[model samples]
Target: MATELRTAAVAGSGAQARPVILVGFQAQGNLGLGYLSSTLRRAGYCVELLDIELPPDDIVAAIRRADPILVGFSLIFQFYIRRYGDLIRTLRAHGVDCHFTMGGHYPSLSSRQTLTTVPELDSVVRFEGEITLLEMVAALAEGRDWTGIPGLIHRRGGDIVANAARPLVEDLDSLPYPERSFAPEIVLGHKALPILASRGCARTCSFCSIHTFYRTAPGKVVRTRRPAEVVQEMQLLHRERGITIFLFQDDDFPLFGKKWRAWAHAFVDELHRSGLVGRMIWKISCRADAVDAELFVRMRDAGLYIVYMGLESGTEEGLVTLNKGITVAQNRLAVQTLKQLGIMFEFGFMLLDPSSTFESVHGNVAFLRDIVGDGSAAATFCKMLPYDGTPIKDALEQSGRLKGDVCAPDYDFLDPRLDAFYQALARIVDVTGWIHGHRALTPQLNWAWNELAVIRQLFPRLPDTDAYEAALRNLTRESNDLLFTVVENVATIFATGKGCEPDPQALRRQCDMALSRLLHERNAFMARHQTVLLRALQQAAA
Candidate 1:
């Protein structure tokens, strides 16, 4: 699949020759690699952007076909570290001698460990990869010393040398827009482009690695693109690609407070002046406390449809423990304001963490219910996974709660009963229609929502009054219903003891049956809706 995708991308780009190939893996488009590709190509280097979601053999085949000098993997998560390591080995075994390098969150945090463990990786670019990668590519091409390059870790002799970190790009407007043209298929929902209006974040959440990654450098933690510059990219994407949906991939969008009020007003004003706001809808993420009702109203009037907030926890204690710097009241107010303004919003919640107890878990459950109510599954909760460079992980390690190495860590519950209940809940959720093993439910739902959003955008283009939109919404409600049912069952076990049910296996079987029924219903719904949507699209086009 990856090979085919790469070939299609190359053909689309009208490139007749092999080029330097950069690999990236993500559920969404790889914006980091996109930025790198754009920079390198603008410097006159041929670059091919390949997503590593394809099978290993396909990846090897694609790289072999390219026969490029360098192959860099953007390592965003530790989960894929081992997988990419094996891939590098396979590529080497196939006599592909391309210099393999990796960069992103995991590599930036554990460059030495990554290089030590993954011997096949020639180097690891730390932090923001654009400048470092460009310099490395130049050095590799000209046979120059890449060791002096900042923000790089390269194996030298018997040891790995970690270089100094590169300074953050202060003038974000100086950088060109990411190269989406190399892989246009990566565009979400046909025309929805994932764009970053800013980099880094404002707040330092204990559980997040963003601040840690940025902390490696000196100076301002967050950087912004000029409002005019951002608007210019929107206009360009709209004019060139007919894109109508702009998903701002900013860490803290609108910077929603007094500190960035001038920037915010300028951005909103630019959106209005550019006339791009009239033609496109946008989605963004921001802190719960950062949002302002008045500013959001203006934004909504400028085609803002969705807002994603990191609610993280429901209890004030949980928020404090995570060092989220926002109160529970603030979270409530934010949700209420968005709701009052008729803006569609989604949130993230960490249900279980190192400090989780039965009481806290119960509070979280109640909080989630209070916010979204019963049968609202769009907002999903997750167990906090400790990534490298997070304060939470450091605290867990210091307290000896972590059970594994830095690459992969595990934590035990303070309460054995709560642990048992969590295990059971995970087992049921893994087996249910809601989630697959280890993968979070939110990403799955987000993927589904993106697909549906694309279809919804097309629905209005349909001349006939079709029921597909209703079907899609009904499917979402039904999915959420199943999620809430599972949540209630899990809550019951948490309330009572682990032995609350006389037969635990019976409860598991019931959950399984319910999930099976839901999956069957969902399949039928998709079939019905797809037929209606396809017919409508065809008719509208005619």
Candidate 2:
């Protein structure tokens, strides 16, 4: 099948094209579907996307309107299984009876569970989905059996059968550019879009399934595109679509080790050579250990405005437990390096890891204080979930501490009080409601920082810009302190075994106050410069 796929495989040859409908989360550019869609279209098949966020009626109507031969669901997370199942069932009820398939880490890593849970799916396209999905669609169009294809799981004779998986695509550059025709992702009145310079991550963090997902197949765990090719794509997008903000959605941008470091340098050089160094800005997510002042400075010169690192834990024990293989000192150094570099940084943190005690929780909070206390970035966190294909999940299962089912998997801390503390904190975040979501202070500050990055790049000499940034940073610090104080208080009460009535109203009041001030400052800055900003943007678009 692999040989056949590599040889002569294109989905449709009919004079009237057959449309393959892809449905998935597209809030942040669903590159999974984007790539798949491009692959199908490149192979002479039509593809349409139905964003899952749309109302069910609209989704059903769109499917009906397209009348695609196959509907592929991008079930990226295990928790969304029920939601996808319900959606699939709804589709069936509406008499939309096209073939249905699902793909992603959850469906790939646990095919049996995925098939069993989402029984409505005709098959699961496991692992890297481009070739598998394309081949499946081709087989369906050509009236050939797709069940025997590589990288597929399907039901046969009331029993689930898993076929051999295809090796990961070794040459990422060979793949067509991802198809991105959705409504433009606008960031602060500037056009934004996601692009990829590489595919896959080499790290084996316990809570992350990326490494496992890549290693599940028999190929390179990571693959890179030529730097010139990446720059060419950026140039094309900037020229054709007027995209000024490029968000590299690679699992982690290739910037670690000798090979990846060279790739990063080549990328920077290409950015400069292609005349995009001063014309565009981009963001990337990377590991803390990958941060080097010199390399980041070069990247910043190449229009790198933001760096997001996953600093999973603070305590040495917590870091070791999570298999981070980096030190608290390294994390701090990375934060300070990027801070001094003046490149905005955000982070992913786990307030509660699988191994947690009251003392460690406090240590984590203190770490958050030191890193984000200055409000360079807003602070936010949640307890880590043992996802389907992570080492920590297996360990939790071995220790008999893993709770909940495969979907919505969770584990209680060894200390019951820590669990209580987590619940109280969750209640505060959920009820007071100004903490984690898009409209919350954390995300608000994140957006503000993004806008500031744009302004800093476009209008470098604008008057009072520095003051606005300083004001935003102060608001961020206050917001971070408010969050830290609330969490610490809850932790202390829970640790000392004190009966306490947690009042989220206080949290609500503080958050509301902070948010009001943030909005006022942000609005004032915008009002002061909207005319110039608008003119600059309009000319750029022109």
Residue pairs in candidate 1 whose N, alpha carbon or C atoms collide under 3 angstroms: none
TM-score of each: 0.84, 0.97
Q: Whole-model lDDT for model 2 versus the true structure?
A: 0.86
lDDT of each: 0.73, 0.86
Query: Which candidate leads the pack in TM-score?
Result: 2
Measured with C-alpha atoms, the lDDT of residue 80 in candidate 1 is: 80
Looking at model 2, the pairs that clash are: none
Cα shift from native, residue 128, model 1 (Å): 0.9
Give the CA lDDT, 0 to 100, for residue 137 in model 1: 74
Report the alpha-carbon TM-score of model 2 versus the true structure: 0.97
When summed lDDT is taken over every stretch of 10 residues in candidate 1, the lowest stretch is: 1-10
Q: What is the C-alpha lDDT profile of model 1 across 1-542, one tens digit per residue?
A: 22322332333343324467888774567788888888677666799877788888998998998898689998877878888889899999999996889988889888888988799888998887777777777766766777888878888888888788877767776565888743343323345678888898878899999989898776577888888898899889878777777888888885666757678878889998997765677889999887788888888888777889999998878898889999988998998888788676778889888888777877887777667663222557788888888999889888878887655677877877777777777776665434443234434444545544444444544432234434434555555555655665676767674534234455446545544544464456566556666665455334
Position 446, candidate 1: lDDT? 48
